[model samples]
Target: MALKQYMKTLSCPPGCNLLLDTSRFDNANSKLVDVLVNLKRIGQVSVPNTDENYAKIRQIIGNTINDPSVNKDLIIAAIMKTDAIRKRRGNSARNRSGLGDVFGGMDTGMDYGMDYEQYSKEKVTNKDFQANFTVDIEKEEKIFGDKSFGETLKDAEKLGAANNDITSIFPTAKTEEKSFEESCPKTDIHCAYVAYMENYANSLLNFKDFTQFDGKWMIARDKIAAALLHLKSSYKGKEVMQPNLDNFKNVCRKFVFLCGTKANRERSELVKSAIFIASEARADKDDLEIHLTDLFGEVKASPTISKDAAVQNRMLGADYADSVRITGSWRSLGIPSRVNGAESAIDYIREDNDVHSMHAAWHQINNQREPRDRKRERFFYFHNHMLLRIATERASNGLPAVQPMSNDVLHMEFSTEYNIRPENDPEGILDDYNSPPKTCRLTRNTQETLRNELRDLVRYKGLGMERFGHHCEQNYHADLHNLLMKDCDVGMLGYFAVSARPPIFYRIHSEINRVWHDFYSNQRYRRQDIYPPYGLTIRGITLHSRCGRVNQAETFWEKLGTHYKLNHQNFIFRIRLYNWRRLREKVIVRIFMGPQNARLENYFEMDRFVHQLDGNRLSEIRRYDKDSSFVFVKDQNDCGWPYHLMLPKGGDKRPIKYRLLVFVNDVHDQRVNVGTHPSLNNPMCGSNRQNMQNAGLELVDDRRDYGFPTNRRWTFNPVPIVNNRDRYFGYMSSIVNIVHTGEETDFCNQAYFR
Candidate 1:
């Protein structure tokens, strides 16, 4: 019956405008072959005249169409039977090189010489057939004009059938392979450097010869200079390297001493050579130099660690040292960061290294200034939030909560004069020996500089409230945090993995948050402007779990490691928006969450983005927790905040009370395109970077800052403003509570939340 349904969908041929009648063809094996011949006559299928191809086709039909266990095989045979009628009519010169030639002379190892009787009698497993037919179905469908045929052939080949000759019946276009040099853009020094390092790291000469140099820094330096000179001469006129050129050079200088005693130094030199060549060839020297200074000046000032154990103990836990070493080596290849066809710029940022040298290198190389900076700030906030939440959960679990390292402990008083303050100094001794040298004891001049930046960030009112001044203030605070910590070592509060695991990172971010609150506290918003435009009203917001509506949810830790898990129940927010204007309109929906009865400034942004409403009607919007804009759905090795950590870990003794706020505002400029990737259209992970870069060609996903209402402080009480005034914002006060479930509970199945 499934085969019949599949056959019914097959078109007769181009211009025929008719689907095949499955009723006309019987289910008999010979009848199926007759159908294939008829299909070939009508130009649908393309079966090679070779005996081996015919035998494989007959075996596939005999094995699948008659067997109940192999429905997929039947579909394949049915598609091929119908496809031959359409494909054979147009091309008389179909390639007849058999299956070997179709698979680019690769041996399929199928016994095409087997007789039909023996082949039919022997049971062909799907796994065995798939192993032999390894052609990509999508690629095959483009060539054969039948997706089912491609799928079936792939399946049949996997089954223990002599189906290797199937491809010879329908030839596919060959895709051109791109070389590393050709693939890397001339102006992207980062791309070239990564590519060069990948090659150097994997090469035999680098491991055998370069490792022999050991502590011979002088000999290695000369060899590095020679390599750089060669690289410069080779691509002198066509390449431009910037951003991470200094990092590349620094890695070279540190070499076997800092990075490793093996070939890592040589590898670094090779990468530097590529970047230098690219920069000298086409880059503006002055601009490149300026960017290097602005971005990587800290890398130069920070001293390299002589011991891997020290780095592991200081930045990450000593237990993670092995994992870090393994992961770092894997990350250094930069294979994960390489852009694929469907990946946008934001996608690259999400997948870039979270730890190791590559983390900083990734940002420098993929130089999309606005998106990079915006993502950087968002990442900082999100990461810190994760740390704080996890710490809360740990404290609930009877584990000690991570404490924030204070700046005062380091004698970093803003009024102090520049002086050398050592760790063991009696007057100003520092306790955290693990902190980066610069951060442990700041000179008086450095203290003054940091103080000035913080003061400016706190006092600044921004351009104006009318033009996203709140966002400007928020970004300014984040940027100041980066500026303050620029001189810190790369692994210590500079990169994600290391920073997230440290107490000092929280201290720095807490300071930024303090400034952000100060900036927003001084700003005023007109009640009229805060109100939703175009007569749109958010009717109400409700929370629901898998079982039913719920007022509370539970969170627990997964069985292993620091990973926490939300109760299995999938939580969703159902929002109803009424459009009183009586015309279709776009509106932005901003969601914020905070501790119940807490000050408005304590709220944390949950999700914010533009959503459209039906004209003259109420539109119902359902948002799932997994689809939060701040998290990424699991995709390969992509580095994102885990989805399970979306909710805060509740208290063990009592449930943690929280408020859910939803705000709706009318979109004035419809012309501003906020689009997402065609493949991954979810607004959950934020905007697509490529779309933002090519606004003319593709639409951006979202234009709002990472945090909306929560990005700024509120002078007036929002609950009253939303509820009492009948404004566009819908306030669900004290709607949700998070309880800490000490045991491993699968909430999705057990209905514990309900």
Candidate 2:
């Protein structure tokens, strides 16, 4: 008998009427109905959705029907007499029970174990069916019975105990201790010092109410010193201890100055004591000479200060303010997320104050304890990348490129009566460069003071390349930031709030880079500076994408409004070597991109790295955009450039043409061992400072000046430079056209190669 006729003849519950609806299942597949009818005839047995029952039912369905259109849910529902047969009404909840309950709420289109599409395309064997549907007790036993699992459990317990021990060290006041525990991560080695600072900041909030004024600051200084000593004792023999301790001391002194009164001739004793404390806390001879620079403004200065350069610049001009304001609500920024291989955008800001507070916390937790050099390098890299990202975002929105702040802008004079201020300064106390409020004239004098310092630094031209790089980087960059920001509030240009959130930060760093270029432009490499023995030569270059080999690609906006999605592509560089002397050699590969007609100075750095190459007569080196050394792995603490911002938005109608340059140079530094595990392939955003230091490595161990060749002005035209037949420096340049597609693309869906 036909299945419909047979189903009509059976006198069952009204819910069973849904089984007669052919729309729900294939008409040709009557075996599923026959099996359910047999189960009903035998007596309705409730089958719970246990793993064993699910496996058994799935196996029976697979054996009976080869048709993909057969609905497995109907079979399970009929056998178990589930409530799933009841009509769904207006997104209402189902009152399903047992095996039907599990299948009722789920997406019926999806296969529980095997892929639905693959199952439809190929025949399934009994072995394959069991492998897909049944759970293996032996595999579970192997994993749970392994020795490593036991060790992992023991380590987890130890970590828990360590967390408990750390929490116990906080102040005994319940509310304060709870706040500290919530604010700080227990696993962080520097959690103790962070807790101490939290308490110190809280204590300073009530400083005015204290009756005793005598030697109060001195007592606070001693407490900080004692904390440092304790930290040293607790983490003795640890490589990261000293670096973290030094960072703690630096931040502590800054906190004191910000939270304390300004120094003056009348309070000479306080000023002298502060200086003494700063000197005593110095970790090395080259540590910041805090005394030489006036942290606080002149005596009788107001506590309140102007906004940071970012906010101040916006206030100075309506055009700049509108430029940023139009991008989106100033209160919120969209961050992208990837889950189950699908991409979605989420807004992280819940309040207006969240902007500064969230960034402050991120910087504090991620960067406050890094080694001094790594911290400084990260600062530069972060600012530079942020400037590029901002420029790219603006371009995508049909705005002009971000203009670099000219030297004259920094030299511009202001009246003493200028009265612009920020709405709030939540992170002011954490600023290491806190200064007493100053008049506009005093601010101009600070600029002149910085100029004189730079002049003096440049006058002594006898400095070697290494020393020159250090002085130019350490002394000049730090002093420029401090002097430029001295008159502003703690949150203005301080560590806590100097992120790319402000548009003016990009301008300020643009000026800094200009100065850097001026210093390093003339320091070009001689022929002997680069090794020539390897005899490397560039053959040709090819670009590949998911759609196949292509010379042009597209970058589109993500559904999440804030970011642009980069095309997934790889660069294949074919090279040939004539004289292979060693088994292998380490080489540095530098990649850069710029507008086709733009000057060399206008180019943006894509990536630079130290890589190892096997000794062969010919080879092809392939690199992916996602694996660029410039990016950090997507994680909570990542501060590296977003991989999405790798390419700027191209023209809407005609594609924008860009020149891609790749430079290969030999590594001379013997301390660098590139072949070690966790190799230097992605070393730009370092893994961990402690781990790297323990291995006797810096964040970037390459002794060469960062952004070499391009750092200096070797030529006006890059074509000739790449076309040169220099054996020591082999370079290749290619043209890439970027098209702007005004649509959203899922970042995870892009084609990626291993």
Candidate 3:
């Protein structure tokens, strides 16, 4: 329930018993309250007694965030319920007044009353009041060097500096095998900025230019509300709840514009001449040029329509006035891009404007670029490959830019990584992630060894040999000979130098803290090395592995049938495992495909081995999961799941206490990459706190059913990329009960998705 307990619920490394004890309470409800407290602490929760219902609410929320598409009402309802609880709790809730005295008595319209001038004064002085403004070029250059932060940040791969490829280690077949594999960083985080902006704009827009706060806050309030509502609504209904900060910003940006109120009749009449002055008679010969000075900047009205007028308005005839006013200023304020929390607001400009022409002009010609921003404007933004590169470079080099612990996330190459660590076992010179595998001699000797590893995995693990046997010749390893000898596209990692990755699958649990989730249908990428092992999955995480090029609407199950000879029995095991994961938290189940109850005692020692690794040297260095799964995660602080490369066979303890950190020759300056906030000149640097903790706390209920975890609780570890699709179970009744507010989709479109 609490942010700390979130990982615990999932059976992740709760890390640091001391921190766990400090955060966890002994009572059942106390753990539930933990999550809410964390959301509130991070400024996401907005309920009365947030501290009380935190964990329970999060348990509900965690489910919804896991698959937001079908759970829209769940989160909103929880918010309302939390509010109700606050009302019931009276004094206890008041102490946690996140809404503050300023939002006093929001139930009735009377709450609208506020001193706009006074509020503005307050905003100016508030410690959190950082203006969304930019500085002169000289200052910007000094801080980020000559490279404009905007330019450098346009590409996601460049933003993270990931290795170009080589990371297809985890399994998720359906996601890989896509044609378009551009690694674009999510722009949805703009929702936070949108929230901030709407608050700022509301403080200004709703102003009656008077001391009375009553009427003015309505406009500001509505705009912000509309944006928030628009953004929240989408994620609430997703099958796989995704939280993209970029999309959040874009949506909010558009919604804010759309939320703008139209010009009153009085203003329209006054500016009648710039538009068509049709009282009873005709349409104008000239283009209907309405003055638009109010929206852009402060200016004096002129008696005539000066051709070169810097300040302008929408062109309108009488009938056109309403459309122009609504579609231009009012509608522009809430452009879809803005509403969806995206950058490049121009992308969502209304279709009413000749969209093609405007886009062509905006992108192709310098003339159409914003008049004032010509000196520093660019047309394009980051793509996926670039994002992958940046992220890989950062991850391999142990840089803060990209996180690697999340499953199947490192599936592709986005950049030409210039410098970084290799991902190999540190023990041997010939480790999987480091020291390139000896060039596979095309000689008969090399081919035999290659065939052997494939044979081993397939014969013992029931993978590769059978699957690829049909696709190739007797010496299947020969394929690599060509890939390695000619293309140079693939690289060596050890016994198997796989160059592809499954499509990127961000750990769903990783997004537990945020209020919104984003879901998409067509997120696929190239092959990764981990595709082979994911077949042996059951439960918590979604498993994604490679599939050949697919068509639209092709489900994972359909692809699985075509790729393998699996039947209902095997499928049942996979499905049951997935369900178990969603319901139970922090559980990692391995469905051994080979003989069940077979003697695997040698391999079975990992449970105790991991316990021995409790005080690991790597753990001592203080790194947690790299990509804080959700809610302003400070990577490696809470969600890291680092494992040793290549398990030791016939194991007792290892030959040595080896701890390896690989640096890729390709990755660029890996340590300092992070996303840039384009809206603000001075972006936030580093993170607030990682809260690195490993509570190792477990919930107690029926003992036999839980495999005797005892002190070590049975937490669920999501098998990412395993579940074919979200299917019918994503939004179970229990999840709905906690998260849904009973509000229909859009609180209006009950007829549809809700």
Candidate 3: segments with Cα more than 4 A from true spot: 1-449, 457-488, 491-632, 635-748
**Candidate 1 vs 2: which has more TM-score:** 2
Q: Show where candidate 2 strays beyond 4 Å.
A: 1-407, 411-443, 464-491, 527-534, 559-584, 634-637, 669-687, 693-700, 715-718, 723-731, 745-754
Taking all chains together, each candidate's TM-score versus the true structure is 0.47, 0.47, 0.15
Candidate 1 least-lDDT 10 residues: 13-22
Q: Whole-model lDDT for model 3 versus the true structure?
A: 0.21
* Residue 614 in model 2: lDDT: 78
What local distance difference test score does each model get?
A: 0.39, 0.39, 0.21
Rank order (by TM-score, best first):
2, 1, 3
Best by TM-score: 2
Q: Give all candidate RMSDs, comma-separated.
A: 20.7, 24.3, 31.6
Top lDDT prediction, candidate number = 2
Candidate 3 lDDT by residue in tens digits, 1-754: 3333343442212121111221221232233334343344433534544445543443445343323222222232233334434344552333333221212212211211122233344212222211111111112122223244455333322222222221211112223332111121111223223333334454454232321112232233333333332222222221111112223223322222222223222221121211111110111111111112211111111011112221222333322111222221111322222112211121211111121122211211121111222111111110111222223222322334333212122232222111112211112321222222222223444345445534442342232222333222122223332323222222221011111111111111121101011111122222221121121222222111121111000010001110111011001111122222222112221111101111111011111000011222121111121211111222211111112101111011111111111100111122212211111000101111111111222111111111111112113321222222323222110100001111111221212112
* Model 1: per-residue Cα lDDT at residue 8: 37
Which window of 10 residues has the lowest lDDT sum in candidate 3?
731-740
